[model samples]
Target: MILLGERQILKVVRFATIGAYLGDEDDQVLLPKKYVPSTLCIDDEIDVFIYRDSKDRLVATTEKPKLTLGTIALLKVSQITDIGAFMDWGLEKDLLLPFREQTIKVEEGNEYMVGLYIDKSDRLCATMHTYEILSGESPYDVDDMVEGMIYSIKKDVGIFVAVDRRYHGMLPISEALRIYKRGDMIKARVVEKDEEGKLKLSLRLKPLEQIDKDSYTILKEIEKQGGFLALNDSSEPDEIRKQLSMSKKSFKKGLGRLLREEKVELKEDGISLKKL
Candidate 1:
C-alpha cells in the first residue's frame, strides 16, 4: 500500500519524467528529480521516504538520508558547495547539509555524524550539532551508557544532541530537566534508541548528583520565598539560570521532592517553607 508520511521499501516499477515511480498496490508514485541518483534503475529494491508535498501530494525522494525515517545511520560527506555540502548516505542522491545548518564549515571528504530529518521545506538535511538529543540519553537501562559532548542549542526541540558524535539524539522540551546552553560539557546515558536509531539521553543521571545538589540549594531559596517564587518557567531561562545553572527539568525535580516531603510548599503566589 502507498503509505503517506512514512518511509517504505518499494521496488521501482517504472521510470517517469521526474524520476522513477515505485509501484504501490493502487498507483505509481513519483520519486522526484533532485532526489534521484544517476545509477537507480528499474526493479531496483530501494528505500524511499514517502511524504506529502506542498500540495499534499504523495512524493518520494532518494536523497542521501541521515537516518532512515525511523532508523539512524552514520553518513559521510561526499562534496561541499557554496550553498551546502552533500553527504553520501547510500541513496540515489547525496543529502544536502545547508551551510546555515552547519556548526562548522565542512571540507570535502570530511565526515560528521548527523541527525537526518525532513525540514520545513521538505528537503533532506543534516547537522553536526546535536546536544539536546544527546541529553535525553540518560535514565538508560543497565549498561546502556554512551559518551558524547554538547554541540549546540537554539531554543527548539529543547536541545539537539549528538551521541558519540555519530548518533543523533533529541532531548525534547519535556525531557530536558536542566538548563543547558550551547557547548556545555555533559556526559549522558543512552536511555533508548528509537526505531530511527535516534538516542534519548539524560543529564540527570547519578553522576551529576553534585550538580543536582547545588540545584537543590536554589530550590530551597525559591521555596523560602513561598510557593509563588518569582522564578517564572519562562523568565530569561539564561539569566535566572545563573542561580541554579541547571536544566529546568532538574530544577523542578529537586523542588518537587522538597515539596512532596513537606519541606516546602509552592503556592500560586510563591514558594514557602513548610511550617513545623
Candidate 2:
C-alpha cells in the first residue's frame, strides 16, 4: 500500500493530460505533468514523494519537503487560523499543526520544531511535541563529529538537534561557537552524554583543527588591518568575539603561536606583525 508523507517507488499505471498515475493495488496518486519525468512511460517505476494536496487528496511530486512522516524539523508558521496553524513546508499544501498537536500556542511568522504525522482524519499534520519522537539510540561516541539540523533553542539549555535527522543531540551553550537559529544545519562534535543520556555536542572544531582556523583568521585580520590588531591575550572575551569571532582562549592560543614563530610582536596596547 502506498503511504502518505513518504517517498515510495511505484509503477506508472497510466498516463493522462494532467500527468501520470502511479500505483499498486488500485491505490494511485497523480504525478503532475511538471513533475513527471520526460522519459517516463507506462509500467515504468519512478520514485516520488507523496503528500496531500491543497484539496486534501493524495498527490505525488518529484519535490521533497524538509520534513516527512515520523521526522522532526523546524518549520515556519505561514498563517494562523481559528482551527490551527499552517506551515510552509516547501510544497503546494501547507502542513497543518492542529491545536491538539501543539505543545504550546504558535504565532504567525515564527518558526518552531515540529513532527510530521498523519492525524486521525488521515490528513498529514505537524506536531510540536517532538521530544517524544526523537531516537536517542545513536551510534556515536565522544569526539565523533556528526551533522545535524537545528530544531529548537533554549537559552538556559542549548540548541536541540536531530542528528542525521534521526538521532537526538544538543549543542550546549558552553560549547556553542556562534549563534544559531531554528532550521540551521550545522556540523558538531559529540562531547559526551548528559545525565539523561542525550548527546552533548560542541560546534567548535577539535583543538588542532581549530588552531589552524584561528591562525588563519588572525593572519587575515592582520592583513586586513594593515599588519596590526588592537587585541591581546588580556582583551575581554566579548571584545575578542567581536573582533575575531572566536573565543578568548582561541585568540590567545593563536596569538601565542604567532609570537613563537616570530610572525608578530606583543605591544603594550596590542599586537603588531613582525617585519618580513
Q: Largest TM-score belongs to which candidate?
A: 2
Mark the 10 consecutive residues where model 2 has the least summed lDDT.
172-181
Where is the poorest 10-residue window by lDDT in model 1? 131-140
lDDT of 2 at 154: 93
lDDT for position 113 in model 2: 89
The number of the candidate with the highest lDDT is 2
- Candidate 1, residue 123: the lDDT equals 60
Shift of residue 112 alpha carbon in model 2, Å: 3.3
Candidate 1 Cα errors over 4 Å, as ranges: 1-66, 70-73, 132-140, 143-276
RMSD of 1: 14.9
